[model samples]
Target chain A: MLYALMIYAEPGLDERIPQEEREGVTAEYQALLDDPRVVQAARLHPAEAATCVRVVDGRTLVSDGPFADTKEILGGLALFEADDLDEALEMAARIPAARMGGAVEVRPVVVQP
Target chain B: MLASLVGYLRDFDAAEEATQEAFTIAAERWETSGIPANPGAWLVTTARNRAIDRIRRDRTLTRKIPLLPEPEATMDEFDDPVIDTVIDHLGDTGIKDERLELIFTCCHPALPLEGQVALTLRALGGLSTADIARAFLVSEETMKRRLTRAKAKIKATGIPFAVPQADRLEQRLDAVLAVVYLIYNEGYRGRVDLGAEAIRLGQLLAVLMPEEPESRGLLALMLLHHARRRARFDGEDLVLLGDQDRTLWDLPQLEAGRAALEEAIARGGRGAYVVQAAIADLQTRDEIDWPQVAALYRRLVELTGSPVVELNRAAAVAETGDPAAALEVVDSLDLDGYLYYHSTRGELLRRLGRDDEAAAAYRRALDLATTTPERRFLTGRLEKL
Candidate 1:
């Protein structure tokens, strides 16, 4: 089964930190990506760069700064192919973001042919 | 019968249903032709035949449901001679090691504790979902869903159907033992059937895991406590330890309990269960050493770090003839609303001639006490005060 671990972290976390400290954190992410079980991983741009668009009736509406303002913003995501939820959670726990006052929400990916 | 079926058929739900079908056939056939010479073998053969038929049916359905895996392996595995050997051996001893695997899988740490308890009782204890629901005071539908979800999780996770390797055994053993003791303790509280089932499981665990001293220790602790079941009550009133009639205890069970405890101790290393069993064994004696009991409780507290153990240590301190010191120890601890703690405080206060404080403590204990005997005992103490 495949699980998508959605990483949520404090906004502006990447840019607010020192370059050396950020390198250490990036090293952990690199190690996670190197794991055999990880299918894909991507770090997102800061939430400040996010743009949300929606259609109301016939009109298209564009909004700035994520769909909703929140303390924790979507920072990254990893797609893991694991034997089970327990296996997936094991990988999720190893994500560096999980240890830095952030959280990883693991959801089963709906596989479609 | 079910274990052997599981050995042949990897799927638990299929194996369980096959065993059930085998029993139904036996029920009808035995009524007319009398009992078979080898009923176990008869059931195994019948269940195997049923499982094969089931696989054949599923194979045809696989065409309609493309998502369903082909059941050819189920039929192909039937050709293996190992299945027959396992059946023959299991028929002779009745206990199968596959059962140990099943139990461990049910109590796997990945699953929620509630799910573990529900699954263990259902799968190993042969309990109906309704029976387990009633035991836990939950709705039958809730228990059904719980069991279904747990079983589905096990299947999806592909949890291995084998005893854990030595490296993983110690960690896994703790969960298995906790589930077994949880069942036993629930049964110990007047659920005779559950208690007996727990003891049977404990005995099976001890026999299967002879190298693990904690298994033997658990069985020993349960047997010792169970031996005093008859003397634990007097016409719905809870009988305190001091008031229980020693003669009414089950002598044979006590002897077996002591022997099991001795075996655990003889194995050398002292685990929490072994220490608890040793303390229970000492309590069964005609004369107990209060200081020694206190020492054991202190060791238990160090090992478990449980507040309940500290409370028990206080009781042992009181038994050492210093109610004042015991009261001080009790005061230092925090076990609010625990009936026994309040009653213990009441007893110590009464001994010190502080009647008003003792009466207030007894009243609090009475309010918290749930069992009839406990309420009665507390009321009697309060009346005397």
Candidate 2:
């Protein structure tokens, strides 16, 4: 079971996960910590760090940044190991970060073997 | 090939046409000759000969090989990879260097990052759009579009058939290395699956950039990480660190990885890929060199700040000394969907013998785990407690 928990919440919400919502979600996530299936997690910085590149006229040039600029830059992503699509979706819904302006993208970790 | 083409004729169009023709000749001849001993020389000589012939055939044509307006440097010795390919196309048509450059150029940052690696995999990695789609979990159509868009950009930009130089080199090289490294990574350490493509790409780069340390390092990194493939999992599920059967690790790849890391360092400061390969060496050492590895990873964090790097640093710290210290670092991260965060924390807690907290971590990790192997690995850990 693997999930790419991409936090699409609005940016600049940094250090401010609304106290009530924060408490609820933190608790929910804290509970997930108790589950046996979790494998890895990661939180990303805002999208502003991105610098886009495109080649034109026998030259490779760069632009200022990402395609879309918004408050909710991809704040972070977490990877998890899971059983099936249903289980992954169920777990994704419970993500506390998702409750506060974030959307978690669940994807299976593609194993080569 | 680029170098040879330049030597053949300074004109971009002429060199390219000749190189292509040379390759056509090799592809036809190599099947019968069974690939010459020095494939590169073979390709280079053939392409050069083709260019010369083309000029000779042109009646209305040229003066003396369309000289470079200045004394053209002999293509005798240079680290430029594309040059070697053109040269190799001269004699041996057994293998073409287009596939490698296709990866390098596609990974060139001039094209958008989103599709760079995917396109490289398709053109250079030689994976089908479907195989790439399966790897990224995206649909084949999307992958195809992505590749087409990338090729269009390359066409539109007319990106030179030359290796980057000066500041521009710094900018584009990352995408190039990323393309090779990721391809090799997936190729070498395929999860639950065999990694033939990765090995193929690694060996291919080895041939293309024989003298380049990073090229060697890329292959070394794959060999090193891949050496641990068996120990990384059981027949059924993924194997977590501290739980893996270390004895099953591939000693040869690990040895090669160590040598590659040293070589990269000896080659002086390179880009991130070489740096990362150095760290992988530390991870694979008999007595893991945690502190140095931590420092190396910290440098990586400065460049990438990737959460994966953070988690890895924590693991290094935990291995080096205090599990609690590692847990503190882990707690500070914003990681949520990542499984290693919880799993690493859980292992630390379990080592401390805090059964409840460890169980909590295992549970959290399981909930987040996406693959069957990961689930099984986490569940097995849970049961052990």
Candidate 3:
């Protein structure tokens, strides 16, 4: 089964961490990408750099900030092929953001094309 | 038979439908041909064949599907007394005891609690959607949709149709035990059929998971309470435990319940249900031990941290010749909306010769009491005052 692990990082995590420590975190995340179980991985730009877009009543509405103004932002995402939810969760817990005052939300990928 | 069918089919909804169809056929055929020698084997074979037919007719043929192996005996041998032997020769997939797996899947955490209860009742209780809906006082259509959605969720999440691995077993078992006890509670409240069904489910769970002590504990708890079914009431009025005839209790069930509780204790079952069962075990004694009961209640309070258990502990403390201590415990708790809290306070106050205060507490209890029998009992106490 394939699971998409959506990593949410604490707001201002980059600023809070020392620059050298941030590189170590990035290297750890890079090491995860080399894992055979991981099919896809991406780290998004910070929430402040995000532009929200919505279609309301057939009108294209654009907003300056991310749609959800929460303490944690969508920092990264990784798709992995695992035997079950337990395996997927194991992989999710390995995400750098999960141990750095953030969380990983795992969702099973729909099997259908 | 349904469990085995689910094992072979690997699709809960499809396997259930096939089993239902087989039962319908058997019901019609058995009326004319008389009952089969080995009804279980006959049903298993028929359900298996039906499921195979379903897969063959399925629109999504692109997906790889494992074919269910046929039973060793043919349908023509149904009347033969030797059919049981033939069933025994059937391959591994023919009759796997996957009930525990099915139960865990039904009570999967991905599903809502209501869905878990409904699914357990429908699947394990052999209840129709309408019957489950009626039990829950909901419309048939609503229950049908809920069951459908629950099944879909199980499939969508790929909730494996097997017992969880050891690391996850306890967490999964908790959900399963909760559903079983929930059904028992619903049945315990005047729903005889539902209660009986819950007990049956508990027994099945205990049998399926012999290593799981909590399962046995739950079964013991339900059976012990159920043993007192006959003496629970007198005509239209509720009979207080102290006044009820002990001889009227089911001796066989009480014995079985005691043995189960003993097994739970021997197995080091310290879970909430096991603790609660131990308390129920103490209740079965001819000479009630208030101190022992109070000690068990204290353990129960620690395990659950539930205000209700603390309230029960207060009542138990009152029995140990400590009305004032019991009153203090009750006063420290905040359960004003709960009728039993006030009722216990009233009894304790009355014992201490505080009649006026006792009468006021009884009035509060009476106002909060929901059932007619409880109201009658409270009113009777007030009349004496």
* Best-performing candidate as measured by TM-score: 3
Instruction: Score every model by TM-score.
Output: 0.60, 0.52, 0.65
TM-score-based ranking, best first? Answer: 3, 1, 2
Question: Model 2, range B270-326, lDDT digits (tens) per residue?
Answer: 646676778777676667778898888888888787888988888888878788888
Native-structure RMSD, model 2? 24.0
What global local distance difference test value does model 2 have? 0.68
Give lDDT tens digits, candidate 3, residues B194-240.
77878877888787678889999999999999998778877667777
**Two-chain DockQ for each candidate model:** 0.17, 0.01, 0.17
C-alpha RMSD values across all candidates: 15.0, 24.0, 15.6
Q: Chain A TM-score per candidate?
A: 0.91, 0.67, 0.91
Q: Native contacts recovered, in order, as a fraction for each?
A: 0.22, 0.00, 0.11
Looking at model 3 chain B, report the run of 10 residues with the lowest lDDT sum.
Answer: B74-83
**Of the native A-B interface contacts, what share survives in model 2?**
0.00
Model 2 misses residue B179 by how many Å? 1.2
**Judged by DockQ cut-offs, is candidate 2 incorrect, acceptable, medium or high?**
incorrect
**Where does candidate 1 stray beyond 4 Å?**
A1-109, B1-99, B114-166
Cα lDDT tens digits for candidate 1, B1-385: 8888898998899999999999999999999999999999999999999999989987777656756652332211212133234434533555655557767777887678888988877665656677678767688878877776676666555554566666667668878888888788767777767787788878988876788899999999999999998898887777877889999999999999999998998887498999899889888888988899999999999999988889899889989998899899888878875888899999999998999999999999999876677788899899998
